[model samples]
Target: MDARASAIAVRDESCVGDEFAPDIPGLKARRFWIRNSGCVIAAALLVTLSSTALLEPLSDVAPPTGPEQKKPVVLARTRRQSVTSPKKARLWMPRTGRPETLDLVERMGDGSMSQTSYFDISLDLNENASGSAASSASAVAQVADTGANPFDLVLQDALDARQLMRHSGLGYAADAPKAVRPADQSNVTVTPAQEAMLVRRIVSLPVQPERLRDIKGVIGVSEQDFAQLASGLGGDVVRKGEQLDLIIGQRPAQPNLSEILFARHLAADGRERLLARCDDGHFQLVTDHRPYDRMVAEALAHQAAEARSGSAQAVPKDVAALQDAAADYPKLIEHLARRNVPVKVSLQIVQLLRANGIHWSKTADVPQLDFVFRTAEQGEQELVSVTLKGKGRDRRFYRYVSDSGKPEFFDDAGRSVSKTLMHKPVSAGQLGDGFGWRVHPILRTRKFHNGVDYRAPMGSPIVAAGDGVVVKIDSETGYGKYIRIQHDGGYTTTYAHIEGTPKGLRVGDHVAQGQVIAYVGSTGLSTGPHLYYELRVGDTYKDPTKAEMPAGTTLRGRALEEFRQQIGRVETIASTIRATATSAAHSAVSALTPGSDKQ
Candidate 1:
């Protein structure tokens, strides 16, 4: 400090060198230095504090730098408040379960119009347990708050909520599902019964069999769940009141009393549900569970098993699988025709047809099973019919037998053999005694009897042997009651032991081969109710089996022409198998029932 002060005094001319001195002295210099030191220290502190305060605020307000930033998370849309409708909407049921969406532009309470999306839902009222809704493009579709009560509950009507839910123990008010959501929306609940009904409805195909061939898959159930619905399969099923009830499973609170009306559609669910009764229901919607058609086939298979038990006569010894359209249909049908189905299941079979001179008979494999019905309407005609199990579209139908006589094989010199023989004279037949020298049961003597005795039940029908005119109608003690008919060529035939004369016939009446002649009975010298049939040529008796009569049935003139046309129609139907769709499965058996209207 002393050197710096001496140098500063020498340089400054105002100082006047070191020999001169100031009048104020050292006190003024000390006072100036104290003030300068205070100003410098205060300035430094002010600069540090100001910088720190500015920096603290900048650090908080500034955008984050580097890798710390992240994208924001989106949240679920809040459900809207419920709205009450002013009046009831139209109530109607939808025929099909096709999905639909509605965009509604509604006016709010404050007069502002708002657009909303409404999804259709279906719920089972009998169920009280929780389930899910059918899905859509987003979760919002599932969670949208319903705008109205959804049901036009006219509680003032005789139908209370409990009555509306059917007789289910679940009262409509407390247990039945409503469109209104709870404050905390939990999963919808369903009962086992509701679920079973749902599955049954989905599996039920339309009345047409062709439509059933390709069934749509079930939506809400699993394979195992759908299978368990066949409760009657494992247990006995009985018709209780109006319903087919199962021995297993809990009985409904009240027996379900309903009928199938063609006018209104009813299903395993309620009798008939209208959209006006309730808007939409929520199910824990399941989708694409399993093969629907296969399950139906399985159900049908099970039904067949039940049928087999009751109808020992109708079911074939060899339970033939349904052969695709082929000779097999005729063969299977022939087999089925021989037996009778139980009345309950008879309608399930689609058809019954008769294969007459076409050679179902005289063939070893194909049984001669002719189920005929007598009609009093048309002079007592007989109709023998069989069924066709029209399989797939394939043309290779199966054969009942291998050695049947075809026209090509029977042709001689490009012309077929002589016309075929007439049908058996008696309704029930098989040669009990041949036309040879044998011990006659009544006479007990060996002699030639030129006729065959057809074994038959009492009061059995006897048809004319061929197209012929009545030659004689005689009642003798030896022949009991007999009718002789003169046929084409010099051939003639006689029916003996007839209980009564054929109805609506006289001496001059020309008769067809299948015309009813008489009823079988033990009228005279006979062992039991049997038809003693004898064939003759030019007044000389011959073996009935060896005798040949007219063919193509015993029709004549206009009647013969009509028969030919009917056969042609039958042949056309036989050829075009699967392509034909008929609603006559029920119609086929309806005629057999007592109260059924004639088909």
Candidate 2:
């Protein structure tokens, strides 16, 4: 035995001897001796085991004194076996939250309510998830059991779904049972040409959600997988024939097709993704849909490239094509019409399209063809309209059309036409801070703060104070994200703590007056969400609140007169909106009145 165990045994022996000789309680002393003897034996065995691997030998020679150590075993949940029956299985897709739990009672052979049970495969979104990775791993592990499927399926991100498939080693089923077709079947039709068109249209769309210009190849995901996805997507997506349509219900008349294409791209794996360039010179994601079109376009481009390298002559153009030689008359007459297009714009449009073979066609009682000539002015713009009359080879037509001293476009789509030169500043409320103020929040002391702060939310629109060139856009550093625009007369304006800058505006990019360049944010050294606006003249910071800055835009002459004429229409619409709102309020009150509807 080790020294410590020997010492403990000797001490216990001495204590037992003393208790027997001097203590009156002999029975209690005998009990203590028995307990000490057991402890000594246990300690000796533990020490022997610690010094050498003799526990196995000891167990063989003697016996175990206590229960043995063990690993807790977990058993998989067993599913009760049922006799096979001719019953159709229908999948129920749950909403964003869990559906009411329905207990299974019995099953009837028919699809009626005579006897049935529904196991609601409801989802609990706010359920205490075991975290993303752990839940994914556990879900994948469940597939290994051969007795029965633990889960029907898990709806997750495309990456997670793919990972689950890989770990689970489940083969994708291309063909699956589909919902029964409508009895009428009047609206459904399958056409080879239409299929080709649909594929072409999908592939031609851009890969990026914002700019659907990338033309990647197409991929054919399994039909079963796609059906499941369609079910999960709810009614937001419409599946007609082989095409999936994602419609933004807000704009029902002109539903955006590109957004739907982007949604599909996001759901697909990177391995099957198609790559293409958008019109804005950015890379976009796409899918492999039309192999033939892509192959043809690639081949043609390659051949053209090879020909160029081999010093080939000019590329071919259609020899049978004809040009319109009598196209300049209407354009020239349209140029002379100052009443319709602004005189300056009319002249410029005529000058640009002077010798070009522009065609004119007549429709109903009004002229339809118009040409807009870009001008050198910062914000001023113009267009020329020409009446036309032509049908075939011998037909000819010519006339001039103009607006006749009326304002052509509303300055703001959200606001009514302005009656005065001074339209209300883009947003309402009041200025909270003067420019070049020195203040501290925590210490309550003075420190030179560069900009004036405007109280607003994180996503409030920040409009351009004037037409200007964006000289700086900082996406990093102490300012967080900011935009500095250099306006006319060497004046510069800066807006800081922006949620996001305008889509394409960068350094040297021009911005029109009143255009939204950024949204307010609390990104930088800010106490709360607000816009830190600064106006600078040359290198000197000016007090924006006190400074009488020149107005950036003005309505003049006929434009002003037209604006004045629009006041009555604007007021009438405003009044109508107010009346409608009041009527709605009154109806709501009446409906809520005690025993009104119930009575």
Question: For every model shown, what is its TM-score relative to the native structure?
Answer: 0.27, 0.23
Q: Identify the runs in model 2 with alpha carbons over 4 angstroms from their true place.
A: 1-430, 442-445, 476-478, 551-599
| lDDT values, one for every candidate | 0.38, 0.38
Q: lDDT per residue, candidate 1, 70-128, as tens digits? A: 56545566543323335443322221111111222222335443332221212221123
Tell me how far candidate 2 lies from the true structure as C-alpha RMSD in angstroms: 34.1
lDDT tens digits by residue: candidate 2, 1-599: 78798567556655665535444464456657777788999999999887667556654234445698455545455443323435433222222211111111111224211111111121221233332333333332232222122112222222222232222222122222144367735445533321111111121111112111111101222233333333434322321111221211111233232222222322323223333433542324455333222222222222222222432121112100100111333323322221122234434333333322343342222222322221111323333122232243221111111132232223321111111111212273245565555666634778777666777756878888765678988866556788888764457888877777867777887665677888888777667777777778888887665554542323445645645544332332223223322332233332223333333
Question: What is the lDDT for 238 in model 1?
Answer: 16
Question: What would you estimate as the lDDT of candidate 2?
Answer: 0.38
RMSD of candidates 1 onward, in order: 24.4, 34.1
**Largest TM-score belongs to which candidate?**
1
